[model samples]
Target: MSTCPTCSKPATADFAPFCSERCRHIDLNRWFTGAYAVPAVELDDVDFEEAESATTPPKSDDFNA
Candidate 1:
């Protein structure tokens, strides 16, 4: 019922979203070659400081104890 994402043909049972092995491979090649990218949100300065503090070790006045 659904169309193949690569060729726009009717999708097959084996490949589901893709029409055939070739089409599937084409889509895979795009991912392997960095053709597709995942989007990320930019972190603010406040968020960066909070993350840094979480990983930093605590200081103690009595280091010898």
Candidate 2:
């Protein structure tokens, strides 16, 4: 049997990943209250042009040799 994601108890078919309605509600409440969050990178810390430049090699100085 699959374990509950919120409480680690045996999961119920009704809730699939959760053991019961209570655990499912608890998980939903966390999302509503911002207890769970997705991480984001600040744009200020990233330089798109600089990142592009790093992936590209500098132009060769000599056409041959």
Best by TM-score: 1
Q: Which pairs in model 1 have colliding backbones?
A: none
Q: Candidate 2, residues 1-65: lDDT per residue as tens digits?
A: 88999999999998988999999999999999999999976555358677777898767864455
lDDT per residue for candidate 1 within 8-40, as digits (tens), equals 999999998999999999999999999999997
Per-candidate TM-score against the hidden true structure: 0.68, 0.65
Displacement of residue 26 (Cα, Å) in model 1 is 0.4
Give the Cα error of residue 47 in candidate 2, in Å.
4.1
Cα RMSD (Å) per model? 4.9, 5.9
State in Å the error of residue 46, model 1.
Answer: 3.0
